[model samples]
Target: MDKLISEFDRALRTVFAPAASVRPHPDAQIDEPAMDIADKRHAAGLMRVNHCGEVCAQALYQGQALTARDPAAREALRSAAHEEVEHLAWTERRLQELGSHKSVLNPLWYAGSLAIGVTAGLVGDRWNLGFLAETERQVSAHLDAHLSKLPQADEKSRAIVRQMHADETAHAETAVALGAAPLPLPVRLAMRSMSKVMTGLSYRL
Candidate 1:
C-alpha cells in the first residue's frame, strides 16, 4: 500500500508539478532570450504538446511499473520513466521561456493514460511491452512531423524536438530488444487513431 501510495504521489507530482520546482536544464545552451513574438508563440504551442506527451509518459510508465511482475520488465519501464523526466524538463523550460501554460487538463490526461496502461498491463507483460513499443514508435514519428511544422526561426524548439525524437526512437528500439511482441495491425491502427485524437486536442486545447 505504501509503495502504491508513493507511486501515486509521484505521478501526481510529475503530471501537475509546478514548473519552477523542476531543476535547470542539463544543457543551458538554449537559454538566450529572443525578441520574436510569433516565434515565441509557435514555440509555446509546440512545447505544450511536448509537455502533454510527457504527462502521458509518466502515467503509462507508472501504471506499467506498478503492475509488472518481472523485474526486468519493471526495470525497463522505470528506465523509460527516467528518460521521460528529461523530456518533461525540456518542455517545461521551453514553455517557461515562451510564457505559455502547461495543459489545464493534465490530471485528466494522466488519469486516462494510467487507466489505459493498467488495462494493457493486466493483459500480459508481452502485450504491455508491445503497447510501449508501438506507442514510442508512433510518438517518435509524430515528433518528426512536429519538427517539420515548427517555425524555422525557432532554433531552440527545433533542437529540443530533434533530441526528443531521437530519445523516443531509442525507447522504441529498447522495448523491441526487451522482447516486445509485434502488435497486430488492428491494434496498431487503433492506437494510432486514439493518439491522433489526443494530439489534435492537445495542440490547441
Candidate 2:
C-alpha cells in the first residue's frame, strides 16, 4: 500500500509539478557555440528529442524505484530521478526559448518508459543497472551528435547540452561502479536504432 501510494504521488508530481531548472553547479563553466537560424532550428528539433528522453528518464526511475528490492539501489534510482528533474526543467526552458512545445505524446512516452523501467527492475538488479548505463551512454552520444549539428551561434543551447552531456557521462560511470552488467551487443544496437527513430520522428512530429 505504501509503495502504491508512493507511485501515485510520483505520477501526480510528474504530471502536475512545475519546475524551473536549477543548476547544482552554479559556478560551472559554460561554453556557448554560435549557430545560424537554420542550425538553430535543427538544434531545437534535436533538443525536443532530448527533452522527451528526460521525460522518459523520470518515468523510468520512478518505475524502477517502485520495485527495487535493494535499499541502496532504490536510493540510487531516486537520486537519478532527481537529476532527471533538472534535465526536464532545463529542456523545457530551452524548448520555450526556441519557440517550441514539448512532444504532443509526452504522456505516451512516459507510460511506455515506465513500463520498460519496471520490467527491467523485475528482471534483475544487474539488468536494471545495465539498462540505465545503456540509456546514459546512448544519450551522451546523441548529445555529441547534437553538438555537431547545432548552429554555431546558438551558444546557450550548446552550453546546456555540453553540461548535460558531462552529467550523463558521470551518471553512466556511477552505474558501472554500481555493478552494471554490460548489455549484449545486439541489445545495444537495437537501443541505438530505436533512439535514432525517436530522434528522427520527434524532430518534427
Candidate 3:
C-alpha cells in the first residue's frame, strides 16, 4: 500500500509539479542567444517534444521498477528514473527560457507509457531490460534529430540535448551489460512507430 501511494504521489509530481535537478543546469554557463520570434517558437516546439518524452520516460521507469523481479534490475530502473528527473528539470527550464508551455497532452503520455512499462516488466527481467535498452537507443536517436533541427544559435537547447543523448547511450549500454536480450525486429518497429506518433503530436499539441 505504501509503495502504491508513493507511486501515485510520484505520478502527480511528475505530471504537475516543477521538477528539481541535483546537477547544475546544462546551459547555466551559456549566454541566451537572441533568437527571432520564429526561431524561438521552433525551439520551444522541439523542447516541448523533449519535455513530453522525459515525462514518458519517468513513467516508464517507475512502472518497470514497480514490477522488476530482480533486486538489481529494480535498482537500475530506479537509478535511471532519478536521472530522468534531472532531464525533466533541464528541459522544463529550457522551455521557460524559450517562453513556451509544456505539451497539454503530458498526462496522456505518462499514463500510456506507464502501462507499456508495466507490460514490459511482467515479461521477465531479460526482456524488461531489453525494452529499456531499446527505449534509450531510440531516445538517443530522437535527440540527435532534435540537435540537427534546433536553430544554429540556440546552444542552450543543444547543450541539454547533448548531455541527454550521452546519458541515454550510457543507460542503453548498462542494460545490455545487465543481460538484456535483443528484441525482435517487429517489436522494435512497433516501438518506433509509437514514438513517431508521440513526437509528431507533441511538437504542436
lDDT of each: 0.82, 0.79, 0.95
lDDT of 1 at 116: 86
Scored by lDDT, model 2 comes in at 0.79
lDDT of 1 by residue, 18-122 (tens): 533243454367655554887677668778988899889889988887787778888888888888888888888778877888887778889988998888888
- Alpha-carbon shift of residue 142 in model 3 (angstroms): 0.5
**How would you encode candidate 3's per-residue C-alpha lDDT over 1-205 as one tens digit per residue?**
9988999999999999999999998899999999999999999999999999999999999999888999888888998999999999999999999999999999999999999999999999999999999999999999999999999999999999999999999999989999999999999999999999999999998
Model 1 CA deviation exceeding 4 Å by range: 19-27, 31-35
RMSD of 1: 2.2
lDDT tens digits by residue: candidate 2, 50-135: 88888888888888877777777777778888888888777777777777777776677788889988988998888888888899
Q: TM per model?
A: 0.91, 0.88, 0.99
Clashes of each: 0, 7, 0
The candidate maximizing lDDT is 3
| lDDT-superior candidate, 1 or 3 | 3
